[model samples]
Target: MSSIHSVTPTFDEQVPFAAIKERIVQAMCAASLGAVLLFGAGFASMETLHNAAHDSRHSAGFPCH
Candidate 1:
Protein backbone atom coordinates (compact mmCIF):
# COMPACT_ATOMS: atom_id res chain seq x y z
CA MET A 1 0.00 0.00 0.00
CA SER A 2 1.16 3.52 -0.68
CA SER A 3 0.17 6.81 0.94
CA ILE A 4 0.06 10.13 -0.88
CA HIS A 5 -0.01 13.64 0.48
CA SER A 6 -1.60 16.54 -1.33
CA VAL A 7 -1.37 20.21 -0.53
CA THR A 8 -2.83 23.34 -2.06
CA PRO A 9 -1.65 26.89 -1.74
CA THR A 10 -3.83 29.69 -0.36
CA PHE A 11 -4.95 32.68 -2.44
CA ASP A 12 -2.14 34.90 -1.15
CA GLU A 13 0.41 32.24 -2.03
CA GLN A 14 -0.84 32.11 -5.62
CA VAL A 15 -0.16 35.75 -6.47
CA PRO A 16 1.41 38.79 -4.84
CA PHE A 17 -0.43 42.08 -5.31
CA ALA A 18 2.63 44.28 -4.90
CA ALA A 19 4.59 42.49 -7.62
CA ILE A 20 1.66 42.68 -10.03
CA LYS A 21 1.22 46.40 -9.34
CA GLU A 22 4.92 47.08 -9.93
CA ARG A 23 4.87 45.21 -13.24
CA ILE A 24 1.78 47.09 -14.39
CA VAL A 25 3.39 50.44 -13.56
CA GLN A 26 6.59 49.53 -15.37
CA ALA A 27 4.65 48.40 -18.46
CA MET A 28 2.59 51.61 -18.46
CA CYS A 29 5.70 53.79 -18.23
CA ALA A 30 7.38 51.94 -21.10
CA ALA A 31 4.27 52.24 -23.25
CA SER A 32 3.99 55.92 -22.45
CA LEU A 33 7.64 56.51 -23.38
CA GLY A 34 7.17 54.71 -26.70
CA ALA A 35 4.04 56.71 -27.42
CA VAL A 36 5.85 59.97 -26.66
CA LEU A 37 8.72 59.09 -28.96
CA LEU A 38 6.26 57.98 -31.69
CA PHE A 39 4.34 61.25 -31.57
CA GLY A 40 7.31 63.51 -30.91
CA ALA A 41 8.83 62.65 -34.28
CA GLY A 42 5.97 64.39 -36.02
CA PHE A 43 6.89 67.68 -34.40
CA ALA A 44 10.53 67.36 -35.53
CA SER A 45 9.42 67.45 -39.20
CA MET A 46 12.27 65.10 -40.28
CA GLU A 47 11.61 62.57 -43.02
CA THR A 48 14.22 60.20 -41.62
CA LEU A 49 12.65 60.19 -38.19
CA HIS A 50 9.26 59.31 -39.66
CA ASN A 51 10.64 56.65 -41.96
CA ALA A 52 12.69 55.05 -39.24
CA ALA A 53 9.57 54.37 -37.20
CA HIS A 54 7.74 53.12 -40.28
CA ASP A 55 10.54 50.75 -41.19
CA SER A 56 10.86 49.44 -37.65
CA ARG A 57 7.18 48.53 -37.65
CA HIS A 58 7.55 46.58 -40.88
CA SER A 59 10.62 44.72 -39.58
CA ALA A 60 8.71 43.80 -36.44
CA GLY A 61 6.02 42.18 -38.63
CA PHE A 62 3.47 44.81 -37.78
CA PRO A 63 1.97 44.61 -41.29
CA CYS A 64 2.53 48.32 -41.93
CA HIS A 65 2.36 47.61 -45.65
Candidate 2:
Protein backbone atom coordinates (compact mmCIF):
# COMPACT_ATOMS: atom_id res chain seq x y z
CA MET A 1 0.00 0.00 0.00
CA SER A 2 1.16 3.59 -0.81
CA SER A 3 0.08 7.05 0.52
CA ILE A 4 0.33 10.49 -1.14
CA HIS A 5 1.43 13.68 0.65
CA SER A 6 0.89 17.36 -0.31
CA VAL A 7 3.26 20.23 0.50
CA THR A 8 2.42 23.94 0.85
CA PRO A 9 4.73 26.92 0.25
CA THR A 10 5.15 29.75 2.78
CA PHE A 11 5.98 33.47 2.26
CA ASP A 12 7.59 35.23 5.22
CA GLU A 13 8.94 38.43 3.62
CA GLN A 14 7.60 41.77 4.96
CA VAL A 15 7.60 45.30 3.46
CA PRO A 16 8.55 48.22 5.71
CA PHE A 17 6.08 51.08 6.30
CA ALA A 18 8.73 53.81 5.85
CA ALA A 19 9.44 52.63 2.30
CA ILE A 20 5.72 52.73 1.46
CA LYS A 21 5.32 56.22 2.93
CA GLU A 22 8.31 57.48 0.93
CA ARG A 23 6.85 56.13 -2.31
CA ILE A 24 3.47 57.75 -1.63
CA VAL A 25 5.10 61.11 -0.93
CA GLN A 26 7.16 60.89 -4.10
CA ALA A 27 4.09 60.10 -6.21
CA MET A 28 2.13 63.01 -4.75
CA CYS A 29 4.98 65.46 -5.39
CA ALA A 30 5.32 64.30 -9.01
CA ALA A 31 1.57 64.67 -9.64
CA SER A 32 1.52 68.16 -8.12
CA LEU A 33 4.45 69.33 -10.25
CA GLY A 34 2.89 67.95 -13.43
CA ALA A 35 -0.41 69.69 -12.71
CA VAL A 36 1.33 73.02 -12.07
CA LEU A 37 3.30 72.86 -15.33
CA LEU A 38 0.29 71.78 -17.43
CA PHE A 39 -2.00 74.45 -16.04
CA GLY A 40 0.70 77.12 -16.15
CA ALA A 41 1.32 76.58 -19.85
CA GLY A 42 -2.41 76.28 -20.59
CA PHE A 43 -3.27 79.63 -19.00
CA ALA A 44 -0.09 81.53 -19.78
CA SER A 45 -0.75 85.30 -20.36
CA MET A 46 2.19 85.83 -22.73
CA GLU A 47 1.41 85.30 -26.41
CA THR A 48 4.71 83.55 -27.13
CA LEU A 49 4.33 81.09 -24.27
CA HIS A 50 0.69 80.35 -25.06
CA ASN A 51 1.42 79.86 -28.76
CA ALA A 52 4.27 77.53 -28.00
CA ALA A 53 2.06 75.44 -25.81
CA HIS A 54 -0.69 75.43 -28.43
CA ASP A 55 1.71 74.32 -31.13
CA SER A 56 3.02 71.58 -28.90
CA ARG A 57 -0.50 70.25 -28.36
CA HIS A 58 -1.18 70.20 -32.09
CA SER A 59 2.10 68.47 -32.88
CA ALA A 60 1.37 65.86 -30.22
CA GLY A 61 -2.03 65.11 -31.84
CA PHE A 62 -4.06 66.47 -28.93
CA PRO A 63 -6.53 68.16 -31.34
CA CYS A 64 -6.59 71.48 -29.47
CA HIS A 65 -7.46 73.26 -32.71
Candidate 3:
Protein backbone atom coordinates (compact mmCIF):
# COMPACT_ATOMS: atom_id res chain seq x y z
CA MET A 1 0.00 0.00 0.00
CA SER A 2 1.16 3.57 -0.68
CA SER A 3 1.26 6.28 1.95
CA ILE A 4 -1.24 9.15 1.78
CA HIS A 5 -0.38 12.77 2.24
CA SER A 6 -2.16 14.92 4.79
CA VAL A 7 -2.51 18.65 4.88
CA THR A 8 -2.23 20.90 7.90
CA PRO A 9 -4.91 23.37 9.00
CA THR A 10 -4.21 27.05 9.46
CA PHE A 11 -6.03 29.46 11.76
CA ASP A 12 -8.47 30.27 8.97
CA GLU A 13 -9.20 26.61 8.47
CA GLN A 14 -10.73 26.37 11.92
CA VAL A 15 -13.93 28.19 10.83
CA PRO A 16 -14.18 28.28 7.06
CA PHE A 17 -17.93 28.88 7.15
CA ALA A 18 -17.60 32.03 9.24
CA ALA A 19 -14.91 33.42 6.95
CA ILE A 20 -17.03 32.79 3.86
CA LYS A 21 -20.08 34.42 5.42
CA GLU A 22 -18.10 37.49 6.42
CA ARG A 23 -16.78 37.87 2.89
CA ILE A 24 -20.26 37.57 1.40
CA VAL A 25 -21.64 40.23 3.73
CA GLN A 26 -18.75 42.57 3.01
CA ALA A 27 -19.22 42.23 -0.75
CA MET A 28 -22.96 42.81 -0.55
CA CYS A 29 -22.52 45.94 1.57
CA ALA A 30 -19.92 47.36 -0.79
CA ALA A 31 -22.14 46.70 -3.83
CA SER A 32 -25.11 48.34 -2.12
CA LEU A 33 -23.10 51.44 -1.24
CA GLY A 34 -21.84 51.70 -4.81
CA ALA A 35 -25.38 51.51 -6.20
CA VAL A 36 -26.62 54.16 -3.76
CA LEU A 37 -23.82 56.51 -4.71
CA LEU A 38 -24.46 56.03 -8.41
CA PHE A 39 -28.18 56.68 -8.00
CA GLY A 40 -27.57 59.74 -5.82
CA ALA A 41 -25.32 61.27 -8.46
CA GLY A 42 -28.03 60.97 -11.13
CA PHE A 43 -31.17 61.24 -9.02
CA ALA A 44 -33.19 64.45 -8.58
CA SER A 45 -35.09 64.78 -5.34
CA MET A 46 -38.83 64.45 -5.91
CA GLU A 47 -39.48 66.60 -2.86
CA THR A 48 -37.57 69.45 -4.38
CA LEU A 49 -39.41 69.08 -7.65
CA HIS A 50 -42.75 68.87 -5.90
CA ASN A 51 -42.07 71.98 -3.85
CA ALA A 52 -40.92 73.87 -6.92
CA ALA A 53 -44.00 72.82 -8.82
CA HIS A 54 -46.27 73.75 -5.95
CA ASP A 55 -44.44 76.94 -5.13
CA SER A 56 -45.77 78.56 -8.29
CA ARG A 57 -49.50 78.74 -7.85
CA HIS A 58 -49.97 80.55 -11.17
CA SER A 59 -47.83 78.42 -13.49
CA ALA A 60 -50.50 75.88 -14.44
CA GLY A 61 -49.13 73.67 -11.61
CA PHE A 62 -46.22 72.62 -13.85
CA PRO A 63 -43.29 75.00 -13.54
CA CYS A 64 -40.93 72.69 -15.42
CA HIS A 65 -43.53 72.29 -18.11
lDDT winner among the candidates?
A: 2
Alpha carbon lDDT of each predicted model:
0.85, 0.88, 0.76
Expressed as tens digits, the lDDT of each residue in 1-65 for candidate 3 is 99988987677646679898999999999999999977865586888656755777546664453
TM-score winner, 2 or 3? 2
lDDT of 2 at 40: 85
Q: What is the C-alpha RMSD of each candidate to the true structure, in Å?
A: 5.3, 5.6, 13.6
- Model 3 TM-score? 0.45
Q: lDDT-based ranking, best first?
A: 2, 1, 3
Per-candidate TM-scores read 0.50, 0.54, 0.45
* Strongest candidate by TM-score: 2
Span of 10 residues, lowest total lDDT, candidate 1? 7-16
Better of 1 and 2 by lDDT: 2
Tens-digit lDDT track of model 1 for 6-47: 998677665679999999999999999999987887576678
